[model samples]
Target: MEKTREWVITGADGLDDLLVDELLALGGSEPRRLKGAIAVQGDLAAGYRFCLWSRLASRVLMPLLTVPSGNPDRMFDDALKYPWEQVLRPGATFVIRSAAAKGVSTHTHFAALRLKDAIVDRFRQRTGDRPSIDTENPDLSLHLFIEAQQLTISLDFSGDSLHKRGYRLAQTDAPLKENLASAMLMQAGWPARGEGRLFDPLCGSGTVLIEAALMWADAAPGLPRIHFGFDGWAGHQAELWKTIRDDAVARRLAGLQRPAPRLVGFDADGEALACAHRNAESAGVSQWITLSQRSIAEWRAPALNSVAACLPAEWAADVTGAGQNYSVPGLVATNPPYGERLGDEGSVRYLYRAIGRQLRETLPCWDAVVLAADITHADALGLEHKHTLRLYNGALPIFARHGRILPAEPELPLAFEGSLDDLPEEGMDFANRLQKNLKVSLKLAQQQDVRCFRLYDADLQEYNIAIDVYEGRLQVQEYAPPKTVDPAKAEARFKLALQIIRKVMGLHRDKVFLKVRERQSGKQQYEKQGKAGKFFEVREGQATLLVNLTDYLDTGLFLDHRPMRLRIAAEAAGKHFLNLFAYTGTVSVHAALGDGIHGGAETTTTVDMSATYLGWADRNLALNGLPDSHHRLIQADVMAWLKDERDLYDLIFVDPPTFSNSKRMDSDFDVQRDHGHLLRLSMSRLAPGGTLYFSNNFRKFVLDEALQAKFDVTDISAETIGFDYERDPKIHRCWRFRHRV
Candidate 1:
């Protein structure tokens, strides 16, 4: 709407150069570095474009005028000299935000008030009335920056901080502002890495990876935002802005079509990873990110496979090739837990040490960037950085250290890390029971055509663990012993159980993955004892699904649900099926597959809270020749989703966790307490004569008798339990329900 005008762009202090580069690249020129900001000259369109394209700027300001400050009275009179009628319309609302230097006014409030009064008085004098002051959501936002006896009044082009980006709907504790995270990646030479993975090992909520993905995709950071400060300004160019916005959309589409580099993130905290998944999806980059709940201790290269599978079909070969061994050259940029945030110095040191070891021992030939709280904590990494730039996360000064990972050294495998002597006892009585159980379980599994089954589930209480066989690999899960049992004794027994498995099963260490199951307080399906893993395809009955033995406590496929899936396939012909709290959509796929008995289902809707699981569910459905048109995957809390759901389904499968409390959800859920309400909601959407299959892993779960009175109900746990899972009949409970006549 106007010719070139002076604009100041503010960002994190240490990243001014990056902001300057962005300004020049976005139709601005002659950028001059200022304290905490950069000054540039640009037309009105450039100001709006920077708001959309700049990933590291906090605010963009267009200075209306600069005048020297005398006393308060004289400064107010000078402020009135600006033509108020041109800047403000009669009865329009505006707000003034200001910061003043000591030389300008000792009282910042007094300075701001004087400026505010001058604007109002000028409007009143020029016209018949003054504009109203709307502090929140004002039509116009004026900013005053005063220093060295000079005041520069400007309009804040960004109504809100540019760091909002409108993507982070969920977050973890001590999150870095979006702009600061972008600055960190820029300092580390990210999108510039050109072709390698961008990994964040301790990616709390995935701010860094999300920013990196959005930038790489050429998606304007502010493209999704509805409003800007300039929208209400007199000079906003609606047509020019529309043209720029349309071009940005086209650029994003082209960028998405190109092959995207692998982006991966991992965290020990399941809640944080869940937040990250939703954040990436909100940012439209979930398809470009691989997120898993994994401990840093399990971090190692060659084991980290690329999980982002949404790419051009032609490029799948290259992506898969690089993922097989993680041989792609990349940058490891992460902000790990440090003392100030974590408070425990010892734990912080331990985290940093583990990070350093992984970088040096596993990620050879890769460059690394880490943001740490201070030098003391940073040094704990035991890495020699090539450069360290001082910066601030909000107000806390931090350091971004860049270094090249030391070439990996040759390693010798340990015999179970620390071989427990005197535990196996050659022929322990418990070992004998496990051997017998395994033989029976294997025989039953073979006869039933089960590739993955629970072989031994604490058959003997002394060795309290479950050994599962997935194709040929074995995953031994040690269920945490009750507190009444001695810790040392349990540890000894677990070690002995492993030794016996090696001898009896004749499997090497490489073929076995270990997970320790502990009673959890969060979503246990998401929160698992399993470590990071490379997922592989597994054929179960008529459909192929992906599973990872080391990824989570529950393999993406629930072996216990085999009979239920068979039931779904038999009953799903021509019926619209709904699977609520669907973990990996195995049930939905079975419904779509139709089990050689019924025709394929008419439609299927799978709902789950975790975006990670939903992604897997989609791949499962697609693998089984199901199209997205008829098979829809919805990511939402089932409880909340049910209220707005109106479609009626002929066959409904409802399975929920015993207890769950997610930031993505409205409230915490207890299956026993909420089942009645949950079941009633599910029943509302059931078509006449439709059947609902409800199940849960909570051992003590009892179906509410009231549901029986309201709807026809039958206990089907016995029928759904396959031969392999018959031993632990109480492992899970199942039921069948229908509307009463």
Candidate 2:
């Protein structure tokens, strides 16, 4: 019997226990777990078996010696004491990799350089030949590490981290590492206890399915490798390794004689599926696996009677055990992209919810495991899990857990009523209206050089949604239905309408922002719906405005009032401008910067109640190259500011919400009830022959007859409405009021 050799196997953090189990199963003894590595005693054949069978380990290192190290000088002397010519031939190329804890050897690159110097000097003295360093591919790969002033040197037996697997010739957008996929499969109990079936719905590059196929065929992951780091070492025994590999080949041939496990992969991206086929072919497991192109929502479990119908005729075998009467559902394992790497959190949540519902309805008996980068993302799946296996993929921390797919109970049914394959009636009507409206609005926008406008404004009552286009991005707002409407039906209609809009407009998932518009009271209008704080620039006439689509219910720029801002810009020149209830100060920015305002306005003052809106106004003003000395921002109640103002303005723009009860205000203000008092106070500060453009979004707003009698009032609401918004006459009401001189 051969003597046992001490070995250390290193892998990603948090999978130490799994690595230990893998080593112990391959005839290793006295297996011990370290922080992120494992130590075991095994013979030469045992070591060779681990190098060939390990799927989770990154590298297998054979420690030659340990030396006490302090500074660079001592480390160099210690490295030179080891025999280098024996490990490598006279002219064989080599490379030294280094890692150090925060101590005397702080820099990894400097340590690596010192080790190389010592090895090269020793080789020159012994054989009179200095070995050349090959960074890309080396005959001998040396690993050097220093921790707590102790340095240990080892020879890397399995080069390139052992995770490459050498079969993945192509990659998708964010492909998972092969080893991490294998770890997930092991945690799910694949090929152990007669594992039957395997599936990956979102398989990109087919890493998970390919790894499972290898395990099912009883083939080693490294069987296809033509070279390893130990090939050139003098201590390597060639015949011992050949025996181990020959045994693996014979086991693989024997496993092939029996029925192959049903391994399948599906991806919505056809290119990804094609890549999976190429990868499976390279891995020599193409015959045992099947690939298809379909979305997650479209996936359905195979019928129990014909479970293996999708596979080739020669590979189709009984999906059930010999004594079992029915076929069992396969294990589902997938590594779906997280929010940070793929799309937004909301989209990923929607995807996970769809996946969970599909699993519950179709494959309730199947065991599932999903690997997610975030705990929040995993919770979005809406499935209960037994436990999570925490692991690391490169630098990203991940959670791999067993997911429970419960059967749909008769008492409690799923919320989804219909499939999302096509648009419903309400959605179809909404899409047609948007297409018709966009044709005219787009032409009008191009003629006027406008980059933002309303494309659809609740044309279909059943789908109470408004679609606005800013540049190429779309912002959709769904109006809260009345109490008479069904909540579930309303949600279904809203989702379908959004789908239609996205398809018709060719918008990516991230390009469309959705919000719900409800009757807001108090500070609800100013509250944030999301914290993304994403802003995009849109052009209205000459000035640019920054509008946030994801943060709040209402974007900073109101599309219906685009014409009014342009009108204000056209009329103001060499005049003092006042914008009360300024919101984002879009009109002020236009007035201060537009070319129509010759010599520009002397100075502009913008007043709003919310500090957030005030800050947004400041950014808008700065975006258009407007000087602060020429533009001012004030956080105050518009009514109170009107009372204290002593100076008269040449032009004024007042556009207030329908209702507000802000904490900063002395009392709640209603536009319908307070218009009389608001107009009376605002006209007092108006200069002689000055015009005040008053606009309100209240659909039922009525001008006070008493105030109209006192001031020169012209209902120019018709003139303010642009061609795009003419369909909704009551979108906003505007009037030009001046003191009767």
Candidate 3:
């Protein structure tokens, strides 16, 4: 027997055990699993066998040497030790691929250059002729792994990834790699469960379907691939390679001559089906597979001929266990889309539920493998999973859940009727509740011609979300639910609510924005919620304010403060106005542009810490035709600005955050803890007979005793709570304070 060399086979993460089993099943021995790579001792023939036969491998590596290498000189000397003439001819082109430990200086790209330079220099010094470098189609491909102060150089036996079998002509946005798709089928017991049907109803570009066809025909994954890294290597065995290739072709032809399995693929996209056909043709498995343009939602399993026709003798009994006499046993495996947006949750859940229903109504007792990013989606299938395999598709962590589709039950209702207004039963209850709430506010909103207001504030206990309308657009903020509730269920309800709101209001998808509201600390409230900087002008009585529904948690204008802004406009005539913590300066804009029923403000000063909001304030003033010269927009901490103010103002509004720990602040500010100091400072700047208005949304706010004694304080929270916000009195709280002269 020829001496064996140590070989490492690498694959995607979460598939190391499978790859190790594959290597051992091949002619490799002493298989040991490392991180994402499996090490095995194998002869050169065994390496070539794995390159051709192993379906789960990403790359096959033959280790040449290991050397201690942290310093640049040590790395160069270690790489130079290899005999360049043996690995490559004088003019042969090569490329190096590298990976390194966390703190290494030259990790991948730079490390490859260093190793290549050493190889080139060694050849130059020995024969005065160096091999050229080729990155695209290198004759010799080298792999280096640098960990701590050690570097291990290996010869790559697989040119490109084994998954790239020269079959994929087109793909969708997130196609599963071919090798991973094969692993999924193996995990589901494909050919081993012989004579059983295979289906991928959501097949995108048909990678999964084509792999299934190959499995049905006993075809090697690499049989169609024309190139391997060992083709031009020094140890190339052309005759032995040709023999192995010939054997694979003979086996494929023999398998195709036998009765093929019922392998079928269905996709709603016509172009995707066409692409799948092209790929299957290129793979030479087109005759073994069938592709169709149809959605899984309308899919029903074909009827079985007799009890004997049911797959795997136990399936008939299992389907009979669900109180159904007839049974169809097969496999349904698919990689469904992982929706990354809140709006996408509804559709994803609907698809999963539809699959579960089709399996129950049509193909009960069948085994299934569903690859989904969120485990909640698998759970949404309304099936009891036998087990789950964790896997990685690119950088995303996904789960391949294997389960038996059970009989339909009321426990997990399939509520996907395909429309927002016609949501499933549970979702309908919430949508109807929103409809009722909208009815209560629609009349009042139309009478006043109000453009923006809160339509729903968690009207139903189960749906923990708030829906607000800004002119024609809608913004939804879902309050983080307690741990007692299932997150997936909560998310599903939120998605359903958004869709219903859009349909009810006839709003475009782009006009709706959804955000998950979590508990905030520090100045996170001022952070930008999204990258869309779109702002639209909405009417508020006589004033026009700019509002952004997509960029932040709170729109530019506070709808609950509509009545309050009107109050300020009534009393701000001929008065010098001061707005503190002036978010967007809506009140100051009203004061500056008052109708002069009494008189308008002589001058207005709007102070806030956010430059973005200050810029917004300037825009609001300009929109309302208020001149910038009379209005001063000061960007500073309200507390710091209050300390420096000596001028007197007739009217002032101080509405600070309930709690603020902004990084720019010298110290944290809590309305309850520091209200006395804040009030005293602002009151000192007020004229003798001037009144101050203070408000906050702190549900449990309490006025300070010292400040109450220092001035005549009147709680006007009841009067300030407007009609639109009358349902929730604590939406905002306001007070009137007159200085004791």
Question: Candidate 1's residue-wise lDDT over 304-328, tens digit each?
Answer: 4433322222222222221144433
Residue-level lDDT tens digits of model 2 in 384-416: 576688888778788886765555443221111
The prediction achieving the highest TM-score against the true structure is: 2
lDDT of 2 at 655: 91
**Per-residue lDDT for 1-741 in model 3, tens only?**
667989999888888777877888888999888767899998877888899988889999888878886666787887888786787755778888888765766646777788889999889889998788888988889888988767888888888899898889887767889888988888878877634477777788899888888887878888878789887588787888888889988998898887867667777567878888888888887876677655442243332322322222333324566545544467888886655421224335444655676667666677788887778878867766777778888888888888777865433211112234455665677767776667767767777666678888886887778888776667788999999889888777777777777766566788788878788767878989898877776767656678887778678888888888888988888799999999989999888766434545878999999887887787676544353446788989889989988999999999999889887776899998888889899999899889899999888888888888879999998888766788898998898999876
TM-score of each: 0.53, 0.57, 0.54
Segments of candidate 1 deviating more than 4 angstroms: 101-105, 194-196, 301-328, 382-384, 410-741
Candidate 1, run of 10 with poorest lDDT? 309-318
Residue 386, model 2: Cα distance from true site in angstroms: 2.0
